[model samples]
Every structure is written in C-alpha cells, then in structure tokens.
Target: MASPLDRGGLPGHRVSVSPLDTAAAARHVATTEDGQRLSLAEQVAQVPTDPGCYLWKDASGEVIYVGKAKNLRARMKQYVQLTDDREKIPLMMQLVASFDYIVVDNEHEALVLERNLIGQYHPYFNVDYKDDKSYPYIAVTHGDVFPAIKYTREKHKPKTRYYGPYTDARAARETIDTIRKVTPICSATCAEWKRVRRLLDKRPDDAGIIGLICAQKGRPCFDYHVGRGPGVCAGMISPEEYAVNVRRVERFLSGHRSELTRELKEDMSEAAAELDFERAGRIKRRLDVVDGLDDRQQVVFPTSVDIDLIGFYREETIAGACVFAVREGRTVRTCEFIVDKGLDVAEDELVAGFVKRYYDETADIPAEVDVAVDLEDADVIGQWLSAKRGRKCTVHRPQRGEKRHLLETCERNARHALMRYMMRTGYADDRTNQALLQLESALALDGPPMRIECFDISTLHGRFTVASMVVFTDGRPDKSQYRRFKIRTELDEANDFASMSEVLGRRYAPERMADERFGSRPDLLVVDGGKPQLTAAMRQLEQLGLDIPVCGLAKADEEVFVPWDDTPVVLPSGSASLYLMKQVRDESHRFAITFHRELRDRAMTVSVLDEVEGVGPTRKRAIMRHFGSMKRLRAATVDEIAAVKGIPAAVAQAVYDTLRA
Candidate 1:
C-alpha cells in the first residue's frame, strides 16, 4: 500500500543499491558498552548515513527482513529499539546474525532496491501475493509482430509490451473490448488468421470464406461474441492494419493517453462527417468507451512532467527535509529527511548537500529541481547542481498555483512520512483509537460512535479564547475531520460555559453543517470538562433542535459525564474505547498547547538581538553558521567565533561575551 521509502529516508540522496553496503550497518547492529554488548544502540550509531537497502539475515545468511531508510542511522536505531514482541521482527532479529545492503541515491532508488530484493529473495516476512491467475495483463507477442490479446501473469519481458498486472479479469476483458473497438486489431492468433487468409487467397471454390467473414467480421465469435450462429472466422484484421494496431497498443501501454484519446476523437469525427451514421454512432460509442478507461491509466496525474523537487526544515533537535519528484508539477515521489542537531544548516543547503554528494556520482538527475521552501542562496546552489549535471538546472520556489499545491501535498506527505519513520523506529506511536468508541461504550450506545465529536476550549482572560472540535471515526482520531472555532460571546475571563455554548451554536447552524460532504452531525458529542461544560454544550444543541447524544470527559477522574446519568461510566484503561479517548484527549491537549505557545512566544521573544545593527541576515547567518545554532551562537566568543563572515570582529566578540555572561 505504501512505498519502501514510505518506510523512511534512504541514505543521503543516491537511491541506488550496491552490495557490501550492509556490511557497515551490520557491524553497528551491536556495540560494546560498559564491558557488555548492547546491540541496538551500537547498531543505530554505526549505520551509514547513505541511501540504500538493508537486509536482516539469519545465522544461515538467508535474508529474513529487508528495509530502506533515508537515514540509515535513525532507522537502524528504531530496529535496535524494537523491544516489543512483534513476532516476525523478533524472529528475524534472532535469526539475523548479519546483514547485506546496497547503497543508492534517494528513497525511490531505495524502494526499487527493496522491491527487487523482495522479488529476488522472497523474504519470509514480506507479503507474498500469490494467485498468478488473478493478475491478468495485456501482452503483445514478439513473433507475431501483430500480437493478439492474451491474458498473462508474466513480468514485462523484452520485445513485448505488457500493459498490466490488472487485479480483475472482468476489468481486463472490458479493456480488451475497448481496445478492439478503438484499434484495428483482431483477438485471434496470427496462425489461425494466416490459415484463413491462405484459404481465402486461394479462392478455394467454397462459401467458407464468405461465411467466416460474415460470422467473425461484424458479430462476436466462439469467444462469447457469437451465440452459435454462423461461426465467425478469426480473419478480419488485414496484416498491415494488424501491425499498425500493435504499435498503437504499445503507445497505449507506455502511457500515451492523450494520443489514444486524440486518435479515438479523430476517428469519431471522421465517421460522423462522412455521413456513415451507423459507423459514426459506433465510433462515438467507442470514444465514450475509451473515455471511461482513463482512470485505469498508469499515470494518474495529467500535468506532471518533471522528475523532482526537494525541501527541508530543522527544529529543536530534529531536522526534517523532503525531496518531492515532480512529473508536471505533481509529486510522484518523495524523500524525507530527519537529522538530529542539524540546526545551523538551511534546508536548501541540506538539499544541495544531498544532490552534490549523491547525483555527482550517479547517472540520473531530473531536469529541474523545485524548492518548496527557500535557501539562503538558491541561485548559487542551482548553479552548483547544474554544473554537476552538465545541464541548465533551474531551481525556483512556486509563488502560487498548482506548484504551491504540489509543494503543500509534498510537505503533508513528508510530515506523514516522517511520522511513519518515527513510528517504525519506536520514536513515536501510530495507532489511533476512535474517541467516539469510548463515548459510545461508556454511554452504552446502540453502536460504535460512527461520528464522535469532542470539544475543548482554551482561553486566557477571554482575550484569545478558542475552542477546538475534534472528530473520531471507528475509534480513531481523524484529524482532517477536526475543526477550530474562535470564541465571540463577549464574555469575561473563565466564562467556559458561554464559550462552549457559542462554539456549539455556530457549528450546528443548518446552513453551515448542511454541506453533504461535511455532513458531520455527530452520533455523539463530548465536551472536555465536567458537568457544567457538558450541560452548556447540550443546551446549545437542544436550542438549535439537534438531539445529538452528549457527554463530558471529566478531566479530574477521566470519567464519562452523560445525560441523565448519576454515576460516571468508567471505561477500563486498556479497553479499545478508552485508548481512543486517551489519544483524542492527548491530541487536543497538544493542539491547544501548540496554539497557545505560538501566541505566548510572539510576545516573549527577546528583542535585544534585533536592536543590534550588526545582526543583519548575513551576520546572523554567519553567527548561526559557525556556532551551529542560535543557542551555541549566543554562547560563542568574540575572537573564538571571529571566523564568521559579515560579522565585525568587535560585534562577534561582544555577542559571544554578552551571551556567555
């Protein structure tokens, strides 16, 4: 369902694979600490920070688990920390005495390596999708030159254009039908056709040829086209037309949809214009047939044309970066980066760092590299990449339009990817329990809360009071389904009831909630505080004539506050519903804190640094550049940090001593 790099970042940027790459990582799998061997920590530290695929081999040198990571160090570290009883992982760990790897340049390369290795080795842990019969492909025969439609499970062999690994036989059949009507090709084997042609050419004083043409020409044949009428012969397509059609099939297989559509449209127009009403109707029908097949094409995005764009961000102790491959401004591939303590380096520098260190030795480089985020000197970096590529490489940030959307999508994917990476490495949790599940079970509802909405209000003397409503479906927090509301009741500090009431009144107002796509009338509603908060929410919904099930999650004992319930319903801590509630509660708390922090930090920032004349962008860059971070720069020395560019020696010295003092 997800790509191999969806597992994580590959070594640096070269997403290629080579043997001996795993040797270094294997040695790092276990390290000596305090006279005792601690395999995990040592393994994490020793993993090469290059792009590649890693194998987990048993004592017999058989690969058990294969994986890829953008940062081999972090990924290996994650595996090192797999202390839980994941059956396959633990088994693989015990069997894996060593490993092998092939380093490549980027996550996509890593993905290719992983898939190839899986196909080659058929590792035990990986999903082995059997049923060769189910994978129906459209194959063109090499010997025939004008190949017939054949269902197959084979890979794309040389000299033959294999169109699919189609999941459904009916779908494949429909495709074949569309192809037959659109192109001048026959489904019968060339041998059968040639034999029919020989008999016809000889004009062997027989009506067989006429019968065959009539049977097979306009109507279907024994392959379910004709229902035992005069048997049709498999000899309609002329040899030349068959050859031309075969080429068309190749174009169709190779992702030339627009070309196929254009040809179909032309044929339809010609048929109609020629006054061949019957033929014109047939052509128009064929055009409609092909139009419906557009979704089945391999290339989903219609406008993507380029290879990739890359971006990065650094925060506190973690650095995040994403390399988005664009095919016509649509992201077809992405590589995420997470580096620890990489604060001083800009994301563009990191991108440039990866490109230079990687593609410099590789043969593949995309035409243009777009940066969603900026670098200090983008043009210089672009020039560097261009020189290495031996082509005019242009790097630009999108101001607006589809490019921006591409960048945003890439960023969103990168965030999800980084989260996935962290989850894999045990740095974070991925499992989400639906908060509605807990509410329903605790309330003894008819079914799992299909739509459970939780409301939480945060305020400081009612100045920046805001309420957030989060939705959960099937016991999981669906953040995309969440909403935030700014309080506007003109109430004083700590007026939690009015804040709750106002938020509810706006959310359920018919005009707003009536949008079918956002048809989020909750099966259950939950407020974050005790009885008073729950009552306020319920009264507002009641006044609005919405009879939604309402409850309160008491912060004190984390008990459920329900309507007409005297005793609080306490769910088991380990129950699925409780787990869902915990997750939603935690998320809301996080969201609230994050919003509050932004507001707090805005006024709390130290303005003294801004007052300094020498603290321009260049000087600031130099300060952070040499010292590695703002924190370190603040603690730097006048002469000890004097090497920084743009900063006066006196200013550098003063900055260093001032922060130190």
Candidate 2:
C-alpha cells in the first residue's frame, strides 16, 4: 500500500492535486453547497496517488457524489478543472463543499469499496447502480440427492453450482443437452419430482415404477431416451455415478474442454484394460463428441486470457448492445440489451456510459475489455476494473486481429437483437400504435401521446419523501429522461400532494423550462393517484401558466381522473390504453420506492460530526451556544462566523462554504 499523503513529488503519475491555488478553488468553494473555504485544488494536491473511492459532501455533510479512482489525487484534480457537460455535474459541484476518500490496496478492492459505499451512502448525484435484469445461470442443485441441473434466471443462491449467465439461453440449453447425451444425468423439472414420494406409495416396489415416473419420455424433455438420458429415475444412475457425471458437466460448462477430454480419454483406456468393453466404448463416444465440439470453437486470442468483446448498434430511437464472453479465447456466452429511447449521445459516449453502468458493480470485470467503440474514459474505467480484479485491466478499441473479429461478431449479434426487438415492438406491432392513439383520445390530448410523463411518490409515512418522474416516448420507456427527487420540504410530514407540487415546480421551473429539452411539451401527464393528486397537478399547471393535459390513474380499478370531474373516465378493464398507463405508473412507483429507500439508508448513516469540520464537543457547544441552531450559524458571513469565540478565520470560511452550497 502507498502512503495516504500527497504522492505529487513521486514519479510516473499525474498529480492532479496540487497545493491549494487559493485563488482558483476558494472562490468556487464559497458558492458551493458545503460553503467551506478550503481550496479544492490544494486539497487535491494533498491527496495521495492511491487507489480509493472519493466522496463529495455538501455543507450539511451529505454525500452528494461518489466515485473511485486508481490515483485519488489525480482523479480529484480532474474534477477541480471540470468541463462536465453532463448538466448534473454543475449542480453537484455547487454542493461540493469538501471531499473525502478511503484508500485501499488495489484497483479491484477500490471498486468493491466504491460500490459498498455508494449503496451505503446513496449520494444525490450518483446513478443508482443496480443490475436491472440478471441472466440465467445453470444452477446444479449439488446439495440435493437428485441434483437438478436447470436454467435459472436468478443469480447467487446458496449451495448450488452455477455457471454461465452464459449469454444465449438457447446455446446453454443445447450445451446441457449435449452433455446429457454424453452422460445422462437426472434432468427433472421441479414439478415433475415435487410429490414423487406421495405418488409412489401406490406403486409396487418390485415393478419398474420409479423409472416409469421419472424416466418415462415426457414431451421434448430428457433430450434422449429414458435409459440414455440417465434420467434420475428411481433405480437408474446411483448417487455416486451421478456425482461423477455432474463434475464432468460442470467442467464442460466452464469451458474446460481440453482438460475434461484428457480425463475422459484416460478413463476409457483404464476401463478397456479392466475388460469393461461397454463402459470403454461409451467413454470413447463421449470423448469424440466433446473433441468435435472443441474443434468447432476455434481459439480467438493467441494467449489464453479471458476477454469480453462488447459491441453496439444504434439507429434513431433504438439501440442495442451485445456482450460476448470469450473464455479461454472462445466465445462461450452472449447476451444483449435493447435500449429504447436511449440517450442521444455520440457512439463512444453511449458505449462508455453503458459499460460504466453495466459492470459498475460487477466484481468479475474481464481483464481485457475489448470495446468496439473507444471508451471516453478508457484509462479511468480500466484502472477501476484493474483494481476490482486485483490486476491491471486493459480497455481499448479493438480494430484488427482476432479480438476485432470477436468484436465484429458481437456487433452482428447486437444488430440482430435490435432488429428483433424493433420487430416485436415499435411500428411493426400495430397494437403499440393503437395504444398510443387510444391514450390520446382517452386523455383528450392535442395529439397522440408521443411522450408521456408519469409521477409517483414513495415513502414510509412521509419520512424519506422521494418522487420519480418516468417518461414514455412512443409508448416505450425513455430511461434517459427519467429523474428521481428527494423531497426536501415538509420533513417528517407525509404529504403526497405537497411533494407532488414541489416536484412539478422544480421539474418545470422557469429557468430550466427555458431549455428546449425541459420545455418540450409532454403529450400527457399522468399522476399515480386519484382526485386529490389530479387536482394538485391541475392547480400547479395553472400556477405555472402551462396548459398541458394532465390526468391521474388510480390503482384501485385502473380509473382515470381528470380536472373538473369527480367521476373518472374509466376504460374497458382489458383496454390497451389502460395497460400503458399501468406500465408508466408502475415504473414510476418502482423508481420512487428505490430512491426513497436510498434516502432512508443515507439518513440512517449520518452522524452529528458530519455537520461540522474540525469541530469537537467543546467548539460544538460554543458554536451552538452562540448561534442556537445550526441553520442560524450557516446564514452567517465568514467574518461574523469568525467572530465567535474559539473559531478561527479559516474555519469560519469553511463553515461559510459548507452552509452556502
């Protein structure tokens, strides 16, 4: 581990933190939320060039942002000279009074610590990092007498051997089928075996009843005949034999083809020498099949490093990303996500943004992230990955060689996924178009509901008030336009109507409303509750002088409420328009509840010491005695704050910086 002090004087690293250039940082600090007068540049200069996660705190000692860097000092410097076009950065900067960091041993450790702290703190500006969906892993119930090997959409369950979110579900099924053919392991659906013991009581012990129940060919299941599939029927494949075959299945799934084949070949020879001709013949056939499969998987990378090839395909409102897991230089697993109404950022920016969020908390970041699109923060992200993996990770654009070929394959898959996605939804699906048209008529809007915004509030008896604004563009989620808010007013009071009003006011405030993006008219506005919510929004729009169409969707019966009417405009129970509203409302609810939980979590972690800088009990009492409330002290100017007994001018400036931001 390196020293936790400045490493600016050392060699081979960019020392972003330089001694306080008071003129540059102090002025900016005063206008920030922290209101503290510490020179950020100076603070950066003091930060050691070490692996760690940095926390940006505001005047109230609230963590506003969290990020990790291999070189803490250098990363801090990057922020001090911010050219952040991601509008939120400027807002976050305004509240950043002071910065703190946790040093760790390596980059991988830093990644882990960073994610842990983010979940713990829930910083205001940090994007909520959650894997929206998890892929299927073949969960081999190793703990059971009958180890059921099947595809599971969930990840991480105790006492199970899981392999390959494996990308393509079809490919995984095919692989499992092939493995079963080679060595028929018991493959039974949970439902098939759920009440076997109870059902078996009526059957005779002498009859072949167990096999009839478990091994009987059922539809396209068992992959092979009952006897060949080694279907774990009552008397077939003992626990010992089944365990042996399960190990082989695990090896093959993990991409250890060569080693597994070698072991099989040795076993076949030994069996033949022992005069076990049938067993030897079976082994020979299985080995040949495994060898043939390996031959088809031509090695891509010359050196056997596991790398993931990532590719992107975007057109207009739809974009797709494909990730190909190259294990031992073979493309083994493939997965994709089709993003609807994604950000209108550049190709590289899109790739960078997706990659960051995709593996932001993934502990298993590949050593070489071969991206088809050059990442904007390749070096920074690579450092973070390297730290997470406990080894240096290389992230760069791959243009030529085998790596490039793999990336091209990924791009092809991505394009296909996007085409399939569009085909299933958008213009190809007449129902979607009908739904949008129906929504417009149902809400009596000016035109089709091309863009609809929905609001939902979530809190526990109004404690951690949070609201989510979810946007739907052309009847599909426009995630980039979504926003979450921590309701700052009326703390300790549960007021949905009031919170709804505040969110609307801040969302469409005059200054922000001037921006075309913010001002562009939403075709429809749907609130997640009934008359009271609808009235609140209707009155808010009147106050803002905006004549936007608004309605409320109550869950009790999927009823819609509009202004000037107590009776809701109820649609058919099975109407498509109602479905769209339900989706929008549900999405908003999910978003709000998620954000609210984070706020509650952050509140739980805060301590009184977080509010003041360099102030202990003695100074705390003196300041409290003089100002009474912390809010009163925050309103004081630097000189007035300095005038307090036991307070220094520098500390007073820090206080001013903290309070103002």
Top TM-score prediction, candidate number: 2
The runs of at least 3 residues in candidate 1 whose Cα sits more than 4 Å from the true structure, single-residue gaps closed, are 1-38, 41-51, 56-65, 68-99, 103-111, 118-137, 141-146, 151-160, 164-171, 186-241, 253-457, 462-579, 586-661
Off by over 4 Å in 2: 1-51, 54-66, 70-81, 85-88, 91-106, 116-131, 140-148, 155-161, 166-168, 183-247, 288-306, 314-319, 327-329, 339-367, 373-396, 427-661
How many clashes show up in model 2? Answer: 23
Question: What TM-score does candidate 2 reach?
Answer: 0.45
Count of clashes, each model: 41, 23
TM-score of each: 0.37, 0.45
lDDT of 2 by residue, 276-334 (tens): 99989888888778777768876777776778788878654347888887777776667
lDDT of 1 by residue, 551-637 (tens): 888867668778888788776543445556656676676666566655544433234445555676577656656776455656555
Error of 2 at 372 (Å): 3.3
Give the whole-model CA lDDT for all candidates, comma-separated.
0.58, 0.70
Q: What local lDDT score does residue 353 receive in model 2, on the 0 to 100 scale? A: 52
